[model samples]
Target: MTDTLTVKSQRRHLHPAALRIMHWTNAIAMILLIGSGWKIYNDEVLFGWLHFPDWITLGLYAQHGLQWHFFAMWVLMVNGLCYIAYGFYTGRFRRKMLPIWPRAVIADIKAALTFKLAHDDITHYNAVQKTLYVGVILVIVLQVITGWAIWKPVQLSALVNLFYDFQGARLAHFLGMTAIVLFLVVHVALALLVPKTIGAMITGGPKVTADPDTDREPLPSPAE
Candidate 1:
């Protein structure tokens, strides 16, 4: 019991203040982008059956939506770059999100499905969380590239051609938006299910000594 208490006492703040600030900033930027993007999409939807209603959308019209989208785009870009730099410079990504073995991912998936996944140690990310975080980062990068292609097809003709054409970039951007929305849904659901995570992000949670041994090593292969 004492040993368990000692181990728990080793937990530091789950999120640093800088990260939390960037996180909320990114969240606000994404909300604006999505809302305005929806309004833009409604004007000439790729899918006729999937038009967004005005109440949920950001801007009054497509042109207005474009203005909002552009503003949010710059915000997301600057904030995301800062996040990337901080993650690398602080070794936060390496420490918290690396060594994500496939076996570990599979095990975590099974555990989650069985409702046996552990959240007692909020300090560590499960393999599934790591995978989703990395995937969303890549998806966001793709969204930015595709967005540029759509924004200035004539000036960035090379980029537009890379995606096949203007319509293609639009399609890619829409798909990326869908991916981000799905990630948000899952992320929010998990936060609700594990409420402490939200608190950790908000008030920085309980503080303790830094634990150098916290990082998860790769799971051994089956053959081993």
Candidate 2:
């Protein structure tokens, strides 16, 4: 009986509070940045998807889009930095997030797309989730670099020169935003498809039940 209890505790579902906070905070910040970004982008009507009035602007001046963009950029940067720090300190970065092997990652990706759970019987984040999580982090880093080029073309002239001058930076920035938007769309869709995922995020606990017989396992030590 004691052994069974131990196993149940080990298999208990848990997610760090820090991760949950960062996840929601990042979502909100992205929404704000995207909305404000669209308003700024209307300066030249870059995309025809949405329209904004020229006179009614959020920034001090029509050209002040850069100011708002920079302000929001700082929010994202600071939040991301904190997350990275936590990931490194806790070592959860390696144990939980970093895939054990390339084959594992590939298999996980396949499982995630097919909505199949692994041996644990819970469709927690399969391979695709891990890939996207890591990929998005890389995208954020690139966004920062391209953003710098756009914000300070003169200072970052060398970097901007690699892409295609200031024009290239602008294009990169647009693409980065598009990438996040696409990910968010798919993420939300998947969450709706699997309501348990949404609940898991909100509650910081798995919505799936573990089998008493086979699900018993030792809980990994908490990250130091």
Candidate 3:
């Protein structure tokens, strides 16, 4: 009998280092902001179910919460700014973030709702993913705006006035936080649903199979 060797071709995608840094940084910042924000809100009555003592004294006072909130906001803002700059400079934003056609987005949304893989030929984000990604980015920007409206009311009074009042800004900030929480829940659920996706992000590459019958091609690695 003759011995045979098999060669497997794989595709690389994602920038592991960049992704790791951004992911962990964002995660930490979000956690800090949420915790501190909750503490501050507990000082008043936003919802009955969310109640905490006005003075916890466990290194989580309202004043301390404000400090942590601002600190974490800066971290998220700076990191996000850098990520955006890199995306534009490297042209990845154009490739990955530019909205696909409405028909394509609708198709992807239908496929996702039906739990099917929509595009076999496309390797990058599907239309639905692009829309969600863009939506999350806009949400984050809104968070910054509302956050500033609360943080520096005197300096940003004019901007805050657009929203109506400091109370309105507070409401906007709370809503933004809630949206982020919901997004995170869905994102994490999807990650659990798609194990390969988690692997791709971690390994910076995707496993591929070669077959003459299949229409899908290997995904390309993130540009150097």
Candidate 4:
């Protein structure tokens, strides 16, 4: 017989139903908002060469794009609020997403940079992931605030004033969207790097196999 031994992988329930629903809803809303927002941004292209083409935009014109953006924004806002509420209700904020301490984040960052970072569990997030998740929530809030201010500078005078001016709010909104796009890239890459992660998001669990790398512990291998 060969020296290598074969064993069946173990499956664990990772994302609950509510979590999956919220995750997908947020994703769809973000995609729509970004597409329409890009169309609107093209109306007054700050940098002429940086505009998105007509084919990829949600709407061909600013007025139409604004309509789509407003619709998506409301959905994103409502879904985000629901997700936050569920996280609090189920203690997910404390149990999963809490970054714990400042030093932990620094330590995690160092480990990641040095290629020494390995996950202890598929169900749990590393400090860096937790920190990013928390930061993204703040970014979403900023996007909403800036979006409202830009959409109605005169009507929402008080909110617009928070950013000092309409232009300031517009700049903040643009920057926030950029951060979100970057986060999406990293998020998708990491999901692909790890097996069954996306499947877990869709189906509530991932089939975890033995971790062959010795630098880190195995992923809970069951006895053969």
Candidate 5:
């Protein structure tokens, strides 16, 4: 009982303020970008015969939506940089995330295949979660790169060239957006399935279990 208490108590500080801020910022930026981008597509969709419905998009008009999209793009870019820099400078990636071992992913997946895979503790993300997190970052990077390439093909000719042309960049950007939306769906679903994770992200962390002998709450993080 004592050992269990110690392990659970360790979750007192689940996410640093920096991490939480970046996370929610990125989420908001992504949502805005998606809505605005869909509206832009409604004007002239590159993909298929189907036009993105105007009703589902932001601003009620193509030009208005384009403006919003550009604004959201800037927000995504700046917030993304902060997220990356914070992860690197603070060692958040090394310490809290990507703690994989030989066959650990396979083991975790197999265990999760039983379909009760919700993990409550922020300190104990499984291999599958880590992999998904990494994937989401990569997708975000791709979105940024391709978005920049399309936004200013002439100014960013070098980036556009890497994708072969603006056409290629646009296609890649569209695919990146699709991937991101799908990931968001899975991410939210998992959060709902997990106990206290979404709440922890919002308000620092869940109320931890104190040992029976002590009625005191855990001390807050003294610094970021």
Candidate 6:
């Protein structure tokens, strides 16, 4: 029984099925929200000179965009909540994302700029990734608050007031959207640079061995 339990415990993957599902669900929801959001933004013209072309925007019209935006919002919110819960319950966040130090972040940033940042251990997140992931999570929460404020200024007047007013909330929402977009761009670029990460998300990467002293087997060299 002891040996059987040990073997079963070691049968883990870098990206578990639940995590992959939530990740892809969140990605699709984000894409839908961004496209529909651009459509809605074009209707209001946040910056008079800046407008997203209709061809790229979702929903085809402002009203339809609003509908799609709300639909995607629910999907994202539910999926995000599930992801957060799972992370906490499984201690994944604590293990993979905690104890981020500024010194490490700076070192990692420098290493990244110099093209020396290592990607051998995809199971662990580097400081730069930890910072970005936490920052983007906060941005998503901000988006939700500002979105509510803009959607129903009177009903959610407190949220609107927190941002200063209705237009303030709109501006906040726009900025949050910009942050998410920038994060996505960086995220996609990083995934492309380390293509195995993408494969891991889809296929769960390599099996993770459970041991008190270490987490994984010897990884192949980066050059391989």
Q: How does each model score on lDDT?
A: 0.87, 0.69, 0.72, 0.80, 0.77, 0.87
Tens digit of per-residue lDDT, candidate 3, span 23-64: 678888888888788878877756678675544322357788
lDDT of 4 at 132: 86
Kindly list the per-residue Cα lDDT of model 2 for residues 120-216, writing each as its tens digit. Answer: 4334445667678777888888888898898889987999997887877888887998898888897798678767667767777753334444332
| Per-residue alpha-carbon lDDT of candidate 6 for residues 151-218, written as tens digits (9 for 90 to 100) | 89998788789999888898899999999999999999999999999999999998875553333322
lDDT of 1 by residue, 1-224 (tens): 46555555445566777889999999999999999999999989899799998999999889999999999999999999999988776667887788799999999999999999999988889999999998999899999999989989999999999889899999999999999999999999999999999999998876745544543222112231
For model 1, how many clashes?
A: 0
Q: List TM-scores for all candidates, in order.
A: 0.87, 0.72, 0.77, 0.81, 0.82, 0.91
Candidate 3: worst 10 consecutive residues by lDDT?
Answer: 1-10
Off by over 4 Å in 4: 1-12, 206-224
Deviation of model 5 at 138, angstroms: 1.4
Per-residue lDDT, model 3, residue 174, is: 89
lDDT per residue as tens, model 5, 41-67: 766679678677666778778788888
For candidate 5, list the clashing residue pairs, or say none. Answer: none
Per-residue error for 160 in candidate 6, Å, reads: 0.7
Please estimate how well model 1 matches the true structure, expressed as its whole-model Cα lDDT.
Answer: 0.87
Give candidate 5 regions above 4 Å deviation.
1-12, 206-224
Best-fitting candidate, scored by TM-score: 6
Candidate 3 lDDT (Cα, whole model)?
A: 0.72
Q: Taking the tens digit of each residue's C-alpha lDDT, what string does model 4 give over 1-224?
A: 22244333322346777789999999999999988988998888756689888888898689999899989988999999998887776556766787468898899899989978786467788889998888888899889889889989999999999988988889889999999988888888878887677888989885443333321122435444
